[model samples]
Target: MYSRLSLSWITSSWAIGLLLVFPVIAIIYQGLQPAGDLFQHLMDTVMWDYIRNTVLLILGVGVLSFAMAIPAAWFMAMCDIPGRKYLQWALMLPLAMPAYIVAGIYTELLDFAGPVQSVLRDLLGWQTARDYWFPNIRSLGGAIVIIASVLFPYLYLLARTSFLEQSVTLMQSAQLLGKTPLQAFWRISLPLARPAIAVGLSLIAMETLADFATVNFFAVNTLTRAVFDTWQGYGSLHAAAKISTLMLVVVVLLLALERFSRRKQKVFQKNMGQESARLLQMKPWQQWLAALFCWSLVVLGFLFPFSMLIYFAAQYFTDSWTTEFIEFSLNTFFIAGVVAVLACLIAILVGLFRRLHVQRGSDIPARLSSMGYAVPGTVLAIGILIPFGWLDHSLNDLIEHFGGKGPGLLFSGTMLALIAGYLVRFTAIAVGAVESSINKIPPSLDMVSRTLGHSPVKMVRKVHIPLISKGCFTAILLVFIESMKELPAALILRPFNFETLATYVYQFVSDEMIEQGALAAIVIILVGLVPLIILSRSIEQH
Candidate 1:
């Protein structure tokens, strides 16, 4: 009976994994098929530009994020600075600010006719455009800066933890050897934390590659935008799928680099207690400088944009408040809620299987399902559309042959497609959350339950579920929040006339009228803050 149950568990896990991963496999298989002209035309025209822009965007974001994050991480982790307690986590606030929203706000302020340059002109006594050489904020360089500003937090979080985990003896030894603080950091600390830094860099790079709205707003022709334009403008799924494949190539490379970095992770990261490491005490002036540097990142990355959002929301309260906004808010909530529940179920299924099975290849289903998280949203959408679109046509054809009215687009043109895309993209978050929680459960509990005549199913229902309930809830919240913020997949898979708050907010942002959507944008930002709150509390407790 246990063997039978084991077979059932493996079969169910595999089935779900294959279904979720099917779109990716389908897209890749379809991408490889010969596309005679339009694909060739795409290759001849904008392909190189897309590749170049994507590479540059990644490279630029990597460099800029590293510069901002490493110093801040070191200050927060090693030096005794004002507000270190809060500043360490406050640095993470920018992660809540969507890249496109930041791009829009900065563009408005820095553009030629906007307040920043206008103020510069007024102060510098320059009258005309030819008289001054202000930077162009709508260019590729601007996109890099804006995206990096928000994304640097990923590096800060990881690097700070890595620094905190280092043994204090090494630092003291370097100091005793007459090395200056800066020199010690450069020679000893930086090399030890290289793996964490590399891992963080890979995350920043992947996110930069995944960004679509920011680049689209800037008119930068990266692979994401290329996929969108080719499919929407040119009416060629074949071309879009091929472009998506190119993006997958980049994502794969980044993932490979991230995994390689992690291979050296255990060697460098010993679990030294944070409090055991003595912090450096800086001079008053140096302390002030450090505080300014840290707070400036908080201000630019989060506080400023968030404050601007609040101001716009208040000023345009009447214009932004509408029946449409409420309806779309409900729409966003409904879809996000459904995806959250479904994703949590998928997570529990696969994660528990991995915990129990423990045999060779047991991890594959979870890994395969998690792969979608690494995929760019645009690529995932194209992958989903290819197979689901075919199934929709086939279903309609079958209905027609049976002399019955067909359910038009039952799969493709409804909430089904959108939900499927969310599951494919975000179930990974749920799985990771659930698996982490499960690992914390004592193995003796599972053994005791089985000895007491509990079946695997009964044991999980009565014991594991209650223990991991908090994790389950956390997983739901994360998936829901991510689904709410998701744009690229929603843009592609949403039913006609459907609008989530993200897409709704994006419409106004794209039209250069962020004030109109400020209220909606605020909702997204507030929702993104939930997990951050949880994270801070967890770190404090630890």
Candidate 2:
């Protein structure tokens, strides 16, 4: 019986691991098959621009995100500022808005013909472009700001968690040695939280690298944009594959840096029973300033874009609210639901396999499976097309050989491919959630269950399932939200005439008709708030 269960665990782990890893393998293989003159043409023409723009965008977004996240995190976690309680969760609201949607809104508002600059021109009596200088919304700098505003929450969440979980004794000791609160924070708290901050920055960096819609919308030539253009614009899948491989290499480097930052860093908690550090009282002016800073981020990052969306939805209700829109919404929900359930199941299988098997390499499968979260959606879409396309071709050939008409694209262009891409992309969230929940359960329960003659499956069903139910819900909710908001993969992989809310919104945004899709964008944002609320509550409890 034990042998059978062991075999089940091993088989399931390897199967899921390979499924997760297959895209990366496919891209690498596609990248290696020589592109001949296509590679040379890219190198001689736009490759330099792609590399330069990608680096600048990553660096710009990283710096700005840290600037926005660190102080807000510090104030919310440690300072007794005015509105701190409200601001704590409000800071996380931006995570609900996709950067591209924000970009679309702001571009309209700040454009030359849009309200902001138009009003400025009317007031100044300016005739034309020669009257005064104004910043371009559709530029590299604008893309950086838009992406950073929506993404800084990644840093804030992690940094706040680190601050909240730090050993109170360390700060108290620093105070005893005559360090002021600010000095102690700078010297002790900030340094100790470096690993957490590094992890957060790495996430932001990967996201910046992965971004396609915002950059493409702005006409910036980043690597992600290059990949899309190379394949769709130039009709060169080989060149696209090469670019995807290059992007993967960059992601791997970022992951390595994150690991290095975490290396040799012992997270000392003093004791599990130790209380968190007390929040320091701020002067009245300091309180007002902190409140202003944090609230400003909340307004700019979430409130402004969300309000604009609502206003547009209201103004265009007749045009935007249609049967087609309803169908799109249903499609989004259907795909998200399917992906969420499958991700949860895979996460459970991998999580349980690692838990039950104490072998030396038992954890490798979980690690491999989660690596896809770091990969860009566009890259993953391209990666998936390779092997699945081949499968479709092989099936069609077999069907023709058997004297039956070929069923076109059995896997590649259908919902099956989209679901597979989503699972590869988001199963990490579920795996992490499940593993954390499982770790909280004592091993003695498992031993006792086994002694009672319960099979491993039955033991999990009767005990682990009920115990980790909340984690399971969280996993499902998070993956669902992510899947709903995902654009690039859905863009590439959806079948003919199929439209998810994200893809639908992207089409409107691309056509500069954002108002038409405003209602759908709002729906996506509202759905995303579920996971943000969950995260906020979880951090507060910690």
Candidate 3:
């Protein structure tokens, strides 16, 4: 009976894995069969520019995020500075603010007629563009800042975890050698944290490469934008597929680099017998400076943009409030909730399979399923449309052959396609969370349950489910928030006359009227805080 159950589990896991991977395979296949001369035309005209801009943007964002995250992580994890407690979690709030929204707000604020420059012009007695030489907020540099501000939390979270987990004995040993605190950190702590930092950098790099909205809004032509333009602007799906394939190649390379970095990671087991290293107390001036640094990041990244959104929401409350707005909010919640539940179920299945069937190839299915998280939303949307559109057409033809009217777009333009995209993109988050929680359960529990004649399903239900309930909740909340904020996939796959909050907000942002969608944006941000709060509390417990 257990053998049959295990076989069924492996078969189902493999089936889901293949379904998730099909879009990528379809995209590559389509890219190989491009429309006449379209691939060549893109290569000759704009491919190099896309490549150059994308590399530059990735490098710029990676460097800036590192600079901001590393020091902040050190200060939070190692220094007894003012506001350290509040600043630790407050720094993560930026993850809720989408970079495109930030770009839109700052663009309006810093534009010539907007508040910042208007004040500057009035104070400096300047009249025109040539008066005082303010920087353009719609340039490559601007996109870098916008993206890095929100994304630095990726690095900060990991680096701080690394810092906190370091063996206290090592740090004390360095200090006992008469090394200054700065010297100890520079020579010992930073080197030990490199693996974690590398993971953070790789995450930042993948996100930078995958970003479409912020760079597109700023008019920086990265490969993602090229994919959008090739498909929508030029009406060439084949060309878009080819560009998406190239982008996938970049993602694969980044993944490889990340794996390589982790190959040498050192695990530090805490010697609970020994006292942990003490946090350094800062002088008053240093404390004030540290407080300012952390508060500046929080204010600039989340608070300032959020305040602007609130002000705009209040100003346009009556105009923006409507039955349609409520309907769209419901639509967003309904779809996100459905997708979250589905993703959580799939993640649990995959996690159980990995734990129960620890064979040579057992890990492959989970890895393949998780790969979707690295693919950009734009790429996944286009990839999904190809195979799903073909399936719809094929089914329609089959129906017509039966002397009946064709069923119209059962999969292509419906919520089915949107849910598929969301599952492919976000199931990885759920899988990671669930698997981490599962690893904490003792194998002895499973053996004891089995000895009592419990089936595998019964054991999972009676043992694992109760044990990992918190992780399951985390997985659901994370996927739900992500699906809510997801813009590119919703924009492309949503049925006609349908609007999720993300797509609705993008429409206004694209038209340079974010004020109209500020309320919805606030809702998205508020929902995003649920997982972050959970994460902060978990870290505190650690």
Scanning candidate 3 in windows of ten residues, the lowest lDDT window is 269-278
Higher-ranked by TM-score: 1 or 3: 1
Estimate, for each residue in 339-376, the C-alpha lDDT of model 1 and write its tens digit: 99999999999888877776778788898888799888
lDDT of 2 by residue, 176-232 (tens): 999988898799889988998999999999999989999999999999998888877
The most accurate candidate by TM-score is 1
Ranking by lDDT: 1, 2, 3
TM-score of each: 0.97, 0.95, 0.94
By TM-score, rank the candidates, best first.
1, 2, 3
Pick out the ten consecutive residues of candidate 1 with the lowest summed lDDT.
267-276
The C-alpha RMSD in Å for every predicted model, in order, reads 1.7, 2.2, 2.3
Q: 271-355, model 3: which lDDT tens digit per residue?
A: 3232224587778998899889888989889999999999999999997899989999999999999988998888898888878
Residue 396 C-alpha lDDT in model 3: 92
For model 3, the superposed segments whose C-alpha errors exceed 4 Å read: 1-3, 6-8, 176-178, 262-277, 358-360, 401-404
List per-prediction Cα lDDT, in the order shown: 0.90, 0.89, 0.88
Candidate 1 residue 15 Cα shift, in angstroms, is 0.5
Displacement of residue 75 (Cα, Å) in model 1 is: 0.2
lDDT of 3 at 182: 82
